[model samples]
Target: MPEHEAGGSLATPAHEVRDFLRRRREQIAQRWADEPLFRTVFTASRDEAVEAGKAVVDALARVADAQQVEDPDAAGFSAVREQLARMGAARSRAGLSNTQVSSELAALWPPAENLLVAESDQASPEELRAWSTTLSVLLGTLRLVAMQTALSETQSLIDRQRLQLLEVATPVIKLWDGIVAVPLIGTLDSARSQVVMETLLNAVVDQHARFAILDITGVPTVDSLVAQHLMKTVAAARLMGAECVVSGIRPAIAQTMVHLGLDLGTVKTRASLADALGHCLHELGTNIVNAAPDGAGRR
Candidate 1:
């Protein structure tokens, strides 16, 4: 509905367009499969690739059926939008780059137009112009939806990976009944500290844990910021009804703490995870005894 009309009716794609697509559907499928870029991006076996190409033609038929070429959000075009979104996400998981998707989408226009032009009764210049201009606009709309859907799906994948890494970095392990351990490694930044606090507090609530051990054995060094983060974690755990016991106080770390006058206050401290777990077990009225002083397990 632009100002470029040339004395012809400006209307949607007529039923004849759908008929053209249906009559030459097989030819469109074969040509789409044969496109070099399409073959490269889809990377399927010969028959399967052609079949996949045919599936694309099927989607195009639906779009033609709906006649919402210029209006992607139209109710009738919802199926086509879903098809495009699924294709975009599938291609992204297949390791196809954004550029390859664009190239293949552009490649589809030629074969589709050829089929339509051959079967169309619009032999006049005005008719030809209308068909060409309309098809061009439709292709542009399709490209926009396809690319945006692919980008959105890719961003979702990235966000999922980001969350997985966050979970992995702040794992909470249940050492025993009423005892959970959160092992800290490397540097303590504000972001990781927050993740740690949330994970520990959640574990305490989930397990009804009375004592949560925060082990910093692999921590490289301790700064005022690191101390503040640890204190915050302890405070948060206490609020969740779980006492915090910090372990893995290496000799160097102990010396640094004393030199800096870093008072951990009334928070319990231990030298190793084994010691912390032993203390936790002892406080919980659970004890481990040697069996026959041999390799037998504790009773």
Candidate 2:
């Protein structure tokens, strides 16, 4: 007999066990995809989903091995059993429903109780049937719990990716001449403002920029909170020995700034990037003439 076939005979029904586990994984994946809560709560990328599936399968294989082990002291059997128990406890704590557990078990061990009874060589029919039914129910519950955990983990990965996408999609430009321009294109909520601050800070440090420009022409309105965030950014830039120049202040935003009784007294403001550049040049005692109307040309 082939080594694999020989090994199979000494252990649990290996082919049947593997087939059952594969089916269970598929069922769980389908159910997770269909579930409203799961859909709303979790959304993983293709790679993440595949990796999570593999992890679930690997864990299930260990559990299957432990269940098939005849001797308590079989190599690595105790550890496998302990791991399964811990998994059970964790699932229970996670609050997976009993129905979910039963469905998962049905996938893992189709006609599971009957199979358990039929597989036992030593137990009498009555004893095997009883034990089989009880074990089958427990197994089903554990399977559901395990799948729920996998779902949670997959969802976490998706959330992280979503955050990364947000960061990547936001346009933050760093010029070669040590100027970082962050254009606020929409509403500035506290959360987004904080993200802006972090992005600017990291970019400034990474590029070793000596100047930062925050252009808010795209912003529709400004509240006191938004003004405060801008001030905070200015202060943070100062701390890093970088000057912050505010630009693109539309009349409406300017009016809102004044209405809020906010003081941008310490912040340097310019009508446009060109204006800011001119101011920078003037501060450095350089002259530019015959330039574009915005004074973009050399003297």
Candidate 3:
């Protein structure tokens, strides 16, 4: 009941579109449920897709009522922003490109268009054209909102994956009773260094480790930043009642540390992992005596 008269003044485009959406909400939802965007996401049941479509239709109607169809930040979009973002992410995971997703969304208009046309029988051609144009603009804004939210979701996923990779790369191994080690093997940045610190600390507490080893035998280089991170990690371990050993300082890296005036006197240093383990064993009162011939070395 949008007060449409063939010979009288008609309602504004916003009013007309809002009324159209309210009247045809069910039809639009039924049609959109079959589109790729909703169909693939709600495969558990067609009813779920229909419900999601109704939510989006309700949001659009609110936007039209507010005369903010072109505004992506309209209050109406807040309710469905997360839903749209998830849809975008799902489509991306399904290997559909942005253009393909957009095309799928475009398919939703025809059903709504048919409904609009049917309702506009009494509308003059001019009024009908205005209503159609308004609806298109509203749809265009919906596309913008969906794409923006999708990009944000993608970035969030990348950040999470990167953190997971860092955790995998900086694994803490329990080498012996009361002894744990993290064998460093890559370029250490602030982020990865933070991960290393957290992972090492967790291992020390979980393993009740007395000696924590940071073996950098596989590291290619060590600069001031890397040294600083090492020192911080060592300090954190000491605070947790575990003494830290810095091992795998090759000859070249040792010379570089000396030339750069880096002083690591506070940290226990060893040339290799085996040497570090030997030191830990010695501290723990374990001994390995030289073996004589004829297997006489058994204690």
Please name the candidate that would achieve the greatest TM-score relative to the true structure: 3
The alpha-carbon lDDT assigned to residue 288 of candidate 2 equals 65
**lDDT string, candidate 3, 1-299, tens digits:** 33323211334887778999998899999989988789999999999999999999999999898888879899999999999988887888899998888888787777888889888898877778778877887888899898888878778889999877896898899999999999998888888889999999999999999999999998889998999999999999999999999999999999999999988869999999999999998998888777776685674
Is 2 or 3 the stronger prediction by TM-score? 3
**TM-score for all models, in order of appearance:** 0.59, 0.45, 0.69
Candidate 1, 1-299: lDDT as tens digits: 32234211434443445566677778887887787644655565766557766666665556656666665554544445655676666665677788877776887888888876777654665566566666665666678777876777768889998777677888899999999999998788887899999989988999999999999998889878899999999998888789899999899999999899999998899999999999999999999985675555553
Please list all clashing residue pairs in model 2, or write none if there are none: 289-299
Model 2, 81-188: lDDT tens digits are 443343434444567564554354355443443444445666555544444443443344455454554556557779998678557634668754577788887777
Backbone clashes in model 3, listed as residue pairs: none
Ranking by TM-score: 3, 1, 2
What C-alpha root-mean-square deviation, in Å, does candidate 1 show against the real structure?
Answer: 6.8
TM-score for candidate 1, please give it. 0.59
lDDT-based ranking? 3, 1, 2
Q: What is the C-alpha lDDT of each candidate?
A: 0.76, 0.60, 0.88
Tell me the TM-score of model 2.
Answer: 0.45
Q: What local lDDT score does residue 228 receive in model 2, on the 0 to 100 scale? A: 88
The C-alpha RMSD in Å for every predicted model, in order, reads 6.8, 12.5, 5.8
